[model samples]
Target: MSEQATTTPTDDEQRGASTLELFFDLVFVFTITQFTHAFGHEPTWKSAGTIALLFAVIWWMYSGYVWLTNEVAPSTPARRTVLVVGMFGFFTLALAVPDAVHGHGVVFGWAFLGVTLVHAVLFRVSGGDDASAAILRILPTNLAAAICMVIGGYAHGSATYLWWVGALLVIGVSPLLSTARGFVLRTKHFCERHALVLIIAIGESIIGVGTGLAEETMNLQFFVQVLLGLTVIYVMWWSFFGNDNEHGEAALDDLPMTDRTRTALIAYGYCFVPMLLGIVFAAAGLGMAIGQGERQASWAAATALSGGVALYLAGQALFRAALGLPRPWMRLLAAILAVLTTALGVYVAEWVQLAAIAVVVYGAIIVDDVIGLRAGERSSYLAG
Candidate 1:
């Protein structure tokens, strides 16, 4: 333990997310809020699909930068400038989302293309040779996507929307085509960044409840439902962080260097999509449930409420499975039950449906805790 013998970890080991990276995340908060606002106005299948596609695009943009920053320092003035520009580009996209499905499709498309281009540029500049080669490999597909977003922006009707779908398809599959080597991950930085994003997504659900309550007259039922919505949010938080999050972080910390980048990409990168999407859905659902009082939920509201929880559970299951953790199957079963609960909601009040989903999530935690006890392992459920 002598000072000379206790060598300093390399820059790579010491690196963490910078202030600019965090500021960039705040932009996405607004983006998520905009998506929630757009969906709340018209909670239908059409709107849902539009929101989902938008969410997918935004998630990719945000996560792609996260990977880049994990590889290189964003503290340099130039890199910091790029982040600011990207933030504006994302902001443009969020602003256009309200009209993305129709008249402003072109605006949305252009803004998204700008963000993706920024990603490519940042990757080229900071991601090293292997990263550059990976960018080169995916360039053609990304270019095609850019074109689709621009053209689709102006194109009308189903033709236009198809282009959006085409863009997402190309970008979505590019990860599979990547073959560039020598990629590395800063494990602690990567896990912390993702966990922070999940926290922000959870905030969206709380915001949903707040917005919903704003529209209703204050009363006992209103307060009760508000508490219910808040409880559901707590359950969602408990379900993730209170379970394997710390263990998963530890797993990443010890992951072999050879497998680090790919494992982080698969585990944290992709799994977050559904998990964050679930928050958005739950927000919309919780808001509707609160606003409607004793009124029954519309198809969109009920689906959003119940399906959101199901998706979160499923995402968690996938996340743990990707990390080579045990009991992912049990989580999967919980997700299936969540899906079934949505159907059952057809016969119950919306608040009741929301409560049912919360109970189910809570039950999943309890079951896991009991299993841990029987197996002589301490569960995280009761931990601070």
Candidate 2:
């Protein structure tokens, strides 16, 4: 294949996220929606596990595209065409997610393979020398994982799960199998791309609230419940957007190229799994709980709502720590308390449980802000 010398952003000319990248992320919105709706329909532990597994596979590839775009901007006609083809693969994957665990595993596997192949080809053709060399190192594992998914698709019963698990394991340790030293890190575009995805994921919670409200009467009680749910979503937005991105970008920028790649992989690639999963679960829970606020929440609904918040807070803490930022004691404490609120839903009204969980998270943000102020820093919850 002829190599296309794509324009790469330099330190002096850092670029923000592009319109094409944002367009690509729209497919991801559908991905999240499908998962949220699936779990909302069957808010059981088994379903949650299936969603988590599929999400890990989908997210790994999705984030790979983010890394790909960070290096080789889809600035050329050929690169743009390849990216759109990848988007179609993602859309197909999302469509299969609703039935991935039940019956459509083969379809899911094929779609994933298409997406993976597109990633490898695009990197090789447009990524220039350094990125092309770096992609070659990780390409085997990427292809291996996709093959595992294809095998898992044809698998039966427990064997199916086993094959998918193998795929996850292969992709999970990819960084260890290959060195990250050959890739370039454009901190600005890298941070912006991730931030946009995170924001879009968070938007799923709002969609959840709307879906939950669809069948209910818009009474004063429903309005209050909506407000409380939105509050939780708002806090989720604030937690990351309120300076975490800046801190994360700055932290990565300070590191050497190789260390920066590793840290970005851990901080953005791995840490974001929990955060995104948390959003998925929380959206599922909130969608289930909204209209039925007066009644006691089902075990699945209660756990999904509160546990989702806990997962997000814990993930945020890990992200901060990976960036060598000060430990978020307040967020950690909130994670514990968020988990404890699961009992509230089981015992009390679901709205009451949601309110309590919201308090826990909002309180953490407030405490962190106070601490930041006291330390003479800006009012950033993650500021040391």
Candidate 1, residue 220: Cα displacement in angstroms equals 1.1
Q: Residue-wise lDDT of candidate 1 within 1-384, one digit each (tens)?
A: 001111122346756667777777778777788877777788888888888887887787788778767766675667778878889998898898888877888888888788888888887766666656766677678778878888888888898879888989987887766753555667778887888878877886687568656657888887778887888888888878875777787787787776766777778877878888888887887877885678777777888887888788788888988898668877787777777777555666777877777788788877986786676654455542
Residue-by-residue lDDT tens digits, candidate 2, 1-384:
365655553542387888999988988878988988999888888888888999988999999999898888877788899999999999999999998867899999999999999999999888878788888888889999999999998888889999999999999987766778667888888888889889988986797669667779888888888888889888888877786777788889898776888899999999999999999989888888887848999899999999888888888989998898765666788889889999888898999988998898888887786776687655355545
Model 1, C-alpha of 230: deviation from truth (Å): 0.7
Instruction: Let me know the TM-score candidate 1 reaches against the reference structure.
Output: 0.91
CA lDDT of every candidate: 0.77, 0.86
TM-score of each: 0.91, 0.96
Q: In lDDT terms, how accurate is model 2? A: 0.86
- Candidate 2, pairs of clashing residues: none
Q: Top TM-score: which candidate number?
A: 2
Tell me how far the alpha carbon of residue 274 in candidate 1 is from the true structure, in angstroms, after superposition: 1.1
